[model samples]
Target chain A: MRGSKAVVGVYSYLDDLLKGIADIRSADLDYKVYSPAYRHEIEEATLPGKSSVRRFTLTGGIIGCTFGWTLAILCSLDWPLRVSAKDIVSPPGFFVIGYECTILFGALATLGSLLLYCGLPNFLRKVGYDPRFSRDKFGLVVGCDGHNLEDVKGRLMKSGADEVNVTEGI
Target chain B: MSKQSEKKEVSYAMVNDLVLRMLEPPGAGWWVLLLTCITLLSWGAVSFAYQLWAGYGMAGNAHPIGWGTYITNFVFWVGIAHSGTLISAVLYLFRAKFRMPIYRLAEAMTVFAVMTAGLFPLIHVGRPWMALWLMPYPNERALWPNFRSPLLWDVFAVSTYFTVSAVFFFVGLVPDIAAARDRAKTFFRKMLYGVASLGWTGNNTQWKHFIAAYLLFAGLATPLVVSVHSVVSWDFAMSIVPGWHATIFPPYFVAGAIFSGVAMVMTLIIPLRKVFKLEPLIREEHFDAMSKLILLTSSIVAYAYITEFYVAWYSNNMFERFQFWFRPFGEFAVAFWGMAFCNCIAPLALWYGPLRRNIAFLFVLSIIINIGMWLERFNIIFTSLAREYIPAAWGSYNFSWVEIGITFGAFGWFGMWMTLFIKFFPAVAITEIKEILPPPVRNKESLQGHH
Candidate 1:
């Protein structure tokens, strides 16, 4: 983002990280938290409400269920090649295809939603990134105006940020 | 030995280093193994090429045994795939902590096994190139594949299983791949990890969705694991073949799949734990837990075997009765009895806790169970087809070099992928292992005075 300034807080301990998150929240600033692994405590502290990935799964499953049956039934009717003298539209037989499609599509959609929400393949968006975030360190990035940049950095340092930096144009 | 003590000792950085170490440049042993796999794969490929050149008659598949060695190989490999999903998805949902260290490799095994299994159908079709006709694509003829046919169900089920599994496997690898990307030295490896990781930074937004999506994938996959084998079972059960037409084939096949799959996991992981020196992470307790699963599934399989016989007798059907009798006393009696000893009797040793925990014993038993499982499928496919409803129409399968070569190649194929995977990817999950470890915490006294 052009002209945007942010304060980055790097921490060594989970306790300090949670405290850092508390400080950012109390200030009512827009912030993003980073960690090496998923923690229920961090999730409970930083994010509100549940992830919307479930909606994508439900939508994909419904679409897949519809598509599977339509493809099976309509194709069977179009061809009209009866095997074993079974019914023209065999729901029992098609149920297997439908079930498999539901899972296949649901899984694909879940992956899609994850990518979209996470801004994945984001090769160029690395203004506040730290390699240690993937290893042992936790980070807290709070986006604020240039005027509030020093104030935010000071607060983050007091909030137990082992290292704090101000980055412009992030 | 308690998990609590182990959790305290392992650090996040150590988990990263230990896992990434496996991704280091291969040693001589690894190259030799890779060469062996490649050589075997080439031999299988040569056999297949020769078969394609000479015609379908090059293989032993004949009048009565149309679904011969190729089908057996297909079912065998698909069975090998079951334990991966069972461990990664099902155990994950149940919060089985032992799965943490081994599930990554298990999931990789599942994807590669499915890839190997997917090839058999193409190879079985003989023409191989015409396999695309199996899909429900638009054509000038306006004819779709018969959805009512269990064969068509196999196509859909297997393809769906493969797609979902590969997706699940890759999704789980993202964070670990990111870790590898950060530590990667070589430019090629760095680029590979960078692209594969999708630039994951472990932000809370990403973790929140990643966790949710992973949970949903596991839920979707658990039922998929059961349905896939069941659909594979329907390929046989839907037929009027005496040995295969039983109602119990779904659960029987599924339990057998898990039995064989878990055995395969043990087969792979025992060697892996030693080679990678991951004993601290993949402990004896994990094997013990896995053995218990094998024991449970083995009992189910044994019951299925007896039930097949009892049902055959109770049905008063001459063909079914004859099929059951011939399985134990006929030309392929060795396969039936071998399967019985390996699958039913061998796993009984696991009921003894000491044997389960003994890594050496588990490794040997795993190989035995795998052999027995292959024999079980062979017994079901070959014996059942070798003598069907009519004695005059019945004929034995011709053991041809083509099928043998192809079967050997299939193992090479699976082995080659596995050998390469361990060297390239973090065989052990870096992130999940760290997740289970106690997080670094500042002292409460120090924190109490802060904010």
Candidate 2:
């Protein structure tokens, strides 16, 4: 293990390439996980061990709906107009607004919540390199600047990664 | 994926029998075709023609009660429509699996209910020809529509809701339409589902795009539904009559909408599910889950009812105070308590888990809820107005037979739409149900070697 920086073009790996790498304290390995149109790597490196940005719970959706409804109601109160001889604050009359607000607020809030939580941008940019990953291959690309780059690559090969590749990021 | 598939066993046969039953000719329960729906529907329409030819007097508009039975039915129908979106988009987004059997039909209900609702305002208008004024158009008249007007809001809310839900419903139906497309041998059927499916091929890419678009529409629509009903609630809440003004009306009305809607869905779906042999697919489990929701919504509505009365009492305002007290003890006390029995008291039947699970009990409860929701609307609209701001303006609202005709006509319109949908499309989304089936039940033989 020696050197400042190096990139290994990991075309493929044996199933047990890292099975024999033993008695090492630790290694600093920077892995970038990418998937093509069809399949992406499992992205173990990117997944937060403690906390994650990607969440699918509906609580966020519900809160957003409720909040949106509350906001719409808050906005509607600006001018409580009289209609057809009835006072503006009647509870039965508010039924229409409440109903409308609930539907609008709940639905819009859910949409807004989903967009925020899903981490979706206007566009998904594509990164190049990795053909076998398209056909059920988990690509593990490790960027390291030490003499043990090969050793790190070897470790991933043993961790059930069918192919290992080093690709340039956009 | 394999483990997920292995997690639960769902005998597809449980639902298969339903499809097979639907495939069979409907049995000898001809009363549904003759006496109940058809008779009621035509009777209503024929009555409506007379209403239009004559005047608003047939339905008992009288002098004080400008709005009568038609408005009550309008609000009632609007309330009845909430469960469709609640089940299809809202519950689906929440991943409530029990919603599967009822989603399509519920969505159909939303569309039909809105259709029926849109009719009443027109019928109630003195000059139906002027209904075009409801539209925001660049006409010669410089007058602007009062945006603050809840009636205008209904125009926006109901139209938006109906349009969006129809799209959402159709989008979800695409895959099923594709399935129907594949299964269909006839020219018209193939053309119908083909165009409806929008050239869908079950490629993963297509499915992804279709799902994404459908999700987007659902997200867009979920709010419109809340907005629609909140607007409806606001129509009442914005009024200053004794019982009409309260802050809780929005949430309370929404709860009632969902409560009543779910009940209506239950009423229609239970019969359809049974007749179509869908008991296995719709399942006791689904009914159990729905019963719990019925209980929850019922509780919220009941809470709203109490909160309303409490606020009226605490406010100590004579007008508001008189509204609540007079409602229970006045000449209309029988009707007031009747509303309570239908909306509030009867739902307690769901408190027992066994009763909630009982299809017959739930069926009866569903009927009661509908009856109660209708009365609740009647009480809200008529009770407050029957006794006017001045004792001189005080007068009772009564529905003449002509008024009754338009009311029933509205129901006929709703049922006709539903009947048409059933004749054309499969009521259940077969593929979606298959997707949600627990793995073992999905692949019945997949568990042989697992120790």
- Which lDDT tens digits does candidate 1 get at residues B1-451? 7876875678888888778899888899999999999999998999999999999899999989999999999999999999999999999999999999999989999999999999999999999889999999999877789989999999989999999999999999999999999999999999999999888889998999999999999999999889999999999999999899989999999999999999999999998889888877998888999999999999999999999999999999999999999999999999999999999999999989899999999999999999999999999999999899888999997799988999999999999999999999998988888877877888655444323
Best by lDDT: 1
Q: What is the TM-score of chain B alone in each candidate?
A: 0.97, 0.91
Error in Å for residue A37 of model 2: 19
lDDT tens digits by residue: candidate 2, B217-320? 56666766567788788777777776877778888888899999999888988888776656556777788888888889989988888887899889988777
Alpha carbon lDDT at B18, candidate 1: 78
**Model 2: residue B322 alpha-carbon error in angstroms:** 1.7
What's the CA error at residue B438 for candidate 1, in Å?
1.9
Q: Which 10 consecutive positions of candidate 1 chain A have the poorest summed lDDT? A: A1-10
lDDT of each: 0.91, 0.63
Q: What is the Cα-based lDDT of residue B137 in candidate 1?
A: 94
The residue-level lDDT of candidate 2 at B423 comes to 55
True-contact fraction per candidate equals 0.85, 0.03
Question: How far is B235's C-alpha from truth in model 2 (Å)?
Answer: 1.1
Model 1: DockQ score = 0.69
